[model samples]
Target: MSTFDYAITRTLDAPADKVWQAWTIADDYGKWASAEEVVLDVRPGGAWSSVMVLPDGTRIPLSGSYVEVVENKRLVMGMDVPGRDEPVLMNLELAADGEATKITLSQTFDTAEDRDQAEQGSNFLLDSLTAHLAA
Candidate 1:
């Protein structure tokens, strides 16, 4: 099995702590993640789950467990994907940039096709995050 890794970095007009809250807090996550339900436990070994409503009205269930969590700094999690023997590892890092926050999101997949698709989805998600912050 080949490993395909994808990463994206973007700066948001919010502080690191605020950005962290947006990710770590269930209610805040639901607002930006297009999830009608969100359950987040932001700690190592903690579990998180959500039901994402797609544009076409498809509801996809996603669950993950945290591998590492550092307040306002980093979060690493393994996401369970259907039909996969292994979970995809996602790593997020945040840095304070004046009044803004710089976030880098990385994920490892089994194929380039998956990686490419994830990249596009991630960009859309980040855009949603930006809009959420602005609101």
Candidate 2:
């Protein structure tokens, strides 16, 4: 099984701590994650899950386990996506940029098609996060 990588970076207008909370805290995560339900245990070896309801009402279930966690700095997880034989490695890094936060999200996928498909959804997630922060 060959793997490919996809990454997206965004500088958010919120502090690193706040951005970290928005991601680690279940409530804040659900606000921008486009998921109907969210469960997060933010520690190494902890578990997380979410059910995302699509625009047409299709529900997709996603689950993962934390591989590494660094408060306000970095997080690494293995995400179990539907129709995939293996979990994808997702790495998130946060850095303080003045009063704001710079986030770099990278995901490893099984194929270039998978990487391309995820790029759109990942962008939407970031856009949603930006809006959620502004609110």
Candidate 3:
């Protein structure tokens, strides 16, 4: 099998610490992890789960590992979305840029389908995060 990857970058008006908090805290992720509503179990081997319940309702569970957690700097993990049995690697970097934070997400998947799902899912989450951080 071949591997595929997708990446996205976002700049938040908030500081790196703030952005890191938003990404790490369950309560904060509940606010930013989706364009709608989501439930994230943000622990070492917990869940990276979600339920889209605004405009529509859908429940999707993803599996992963909190491979790395570097406070306000970086986070690396693995994820396997619904219907897929293989987990992909997800790396998130949070860097300070003056008064703002630059967030970059890179996802590596085992196949095209996995890559596609990651792209769609990550973009959705980014959109939600943008809205959440803006507020």
Number of backbone collisions per candidate, in order? 0, 0, 0
Clashing pairs in 3: none
**Candidate 3 least-lDDT 10 residues:** 34-43
Q: In model 3, how large is the Cα lDDT of residue 102?
A: 87
Instruction: Please say which candidate is ahead in lDDT: 1 or 3.
Output: 1
Query: Tens digit of lDDT per residue, candidate 2, span 1-135?
Result: 788888899999999999999989998888788886799999999999999877788999989999999999999988887777867878899999999999999987767998988888888889989999888
All candidates: TM-score: 0.95, 0.92, 0.79
Error of 2 at 9 (Å): 0.9
What's the CA error at residue 11 for candidate 3, in Å?
1.5
Could you give candidate 3's per-residue lDDT for residues 1-135 as a string of tens digits?
777988899898888888887877767876666423444555566566544444445554444667677788988877665676766678899889998988898987677886897788778877888788889
- Record all residue pairs in model 2 with backbone atoms less than 3 Å apart, i.e. clashing: none
RMSD, each candidate, Å? 1.1, 1.6, 2.9
Error of 3 at 40 (Å): 6.4
Q: For candidate 1, lDDT tens digit of each residue in 1-135?
A: 778998899999999999999999999999898997899988899999999999999999999899999999999988998888877888889999999999999988778999999889889889999999999
Off by over 4 Å in 3: 35-54, 80-86
Candidate 2: C-alpha RMSD after superposition: 1.6
Q: Pick the winner on TM-score between candidates 1 and 3.
A: 1
Lowest lDDT sum, 10 consecutive residues, model 1, at 81-90
Q: Which pairs of residues have clashing backbones in candidate 1?
A: none
lDDT (CA) for every model shown?
A: 0.92, 0.89, 0.74
